[model samples]
Target: MPGARRLLWLIPLALVVTGGLAAGATFLGADRIESDLTARTRDALVAAELPSATVAFDGRDASIGNVPADQRGRARSVVLGVAGVRTAEVTGQPAEQAPEAGGHVKRDLQVRLDQLLAAEPITFQPDTAELTVQGTRSVSRVADMLTAAPANVTFEVGGHVARVPGGDPEGARTLSEERARVVANKLVEAGIAEDRVRAVGYGDTRPRSESGTTDLDRRVEITVR
Candidate 1:
C-alpha cells in the first residue's frame, strides 16, 4: 500500500513539473510574439512616414502614441497591416486642428531618415573613426536628404561607441567625436549649410544593446531639430 501511495504521489509531481514547463514555454512564446510585433509595427510606421509615433504592445494588441491628430488614422492603419497584430489603439492630439507645416515637415524628414538608417546604418572601422565604403554611401544619402530639407530644418549628428573592457573612456569619447565631425564635414561638402549641422559624441554611454558592444553601438545617428 505504501508503494502504491508513493507511486500516486510521484505521478502528481511529474504532472506538476510538466505543467510548469508548459507554462514557461507559453510565457516565452508570448514575449517573443510581442517583440516581433513591436519591431514590425515600428518599421511599418516608419515606412508610412509616421516614425515619430511610439508603440507598445500587450500580447498582440498595440498602443501607439505621439502620432499627430491628423495622422492617427494612417498610423492605426499601418499598425493593423503588420502581420500578427491583432488590434491597434492609436492616441494623440485630437484631430480638431490641422497640423502645421513645420510639424509635418519635421515628421517627414524624420521618417525618411529612419528609413535610410534602417537599410544601411553608418558604420566605422574597429577602434577607428574611418568610415567604411558603405558608411560613406550612407552618409552621402543623408546629406542629399538634408540638402532637400527646408532651410530652417537643422540636424544633429550624434556619435556613439561600444563599451570595451579595460578601455579608456576619454579615448572612446574622442573617437566618437571625431566620427561625428567626419560625418558633419561630409554633410557640409555635400552642400548642406555648415551652421545647420551640429556634432556630439556619447562615449559608450548610451548603448542600444545590452548584449555587449555591437556594430550598432559604434555608429552615428542623425536627429532632426
Candidate 2:
C-alpha cells in the first residue's frame, strides 16, 4: 500500500515536470515567436481592413511595406496598436509633390526646388538635422530666392530623409523637421518674414533621390503654400 501511494505521488510529479518542459519549449521556441508575431501583425492589419499591407518583423519592430503614402499614418496606427511591436514602419511609394500647389510643399517644390538647388544640393549629417558648412552655403542661395518671392506668397520648407535599414524612423522624422526649421530660420535671417515661411518634414516617406539616401534626398525643398 505504501508503494502504491508513492507511485501515485510519482505520477503527478512526472505530469508536472512534463507540463513544465512543454511550456518551456513553447515559450523558448523561435518558430513559436515568429508564428505569434506573424499572426498578431496580420490579424491587426486584417481587422483594420488593410489587406494589401504586409509586415516584416525584426525583433519586436515591425516594418509594414506596400502601403500607400496617403495611408501611411493609418497603417502605423494599426500596427502600433498591436502588442509586442516596438516600432512600426509604413513603406510604399515615396510621397509625390502635389498635383497642384497649396497646403502641400511637395507639389510646389517638385520643379521650383530643382531650380533653386540646381547648382549643389543641401547636405546634412548622416542622422542629424544639423547643416554642414556646405549646407549653410546652399541655403544662402535659397535665401536669395525667397527674397525675390512676393510677400503675398508664403513659402514652405520641406525636409526629407532616406530610409536606412535598421534606422530609427522617429529619429529620421526629427532630423528632417529640424533641418527644415534650420533652413527656414536661415531664410528668415536673410530677410524673409517669419509669417511668410512654413517649415515641415516628410522624413523618408517622400524621397526625391533615386536611391533615397543621396544629398539630393536630404534637401530642404521650397514650395509656395
TM-score winner among the candidates? Answer: 1
Question: What does the lDDT read for residue 223 in candidate 1?
Answer: 93
What's the lDDT of the predicted structure labeled candidate 2? 0.76
Question: Would you estimate the TM-scores of all the predictions?
Answer: 0.54, 0.48
Estimate the overall C-alpha local distance difference test score of candidate 1.
0.85
lDDT of 1 at 218: 79
TM-score of 2: 0.48
For residue 69, give model 1's deviation from the true position in Å. 37
Runs in model 1 deviating more than 4 A are: 1-101
- Candidate 1 C-alpha RMSD relative to the actual structure: 14.9
- In model 2, which range of ten residues has the least summed lDDT? 94-103
Estimate every model's Cα lDDT from 0 to 1.
0.85, 0.76
Which residue pairs come into collision in candidate 2?
Answer: 97-106, 97-107, 98-107
Off by over 4 Å in 2: 1-113
lDDT of 2 by residue, 41-87 (tens): 88777666554578887667788887767778998999898887788
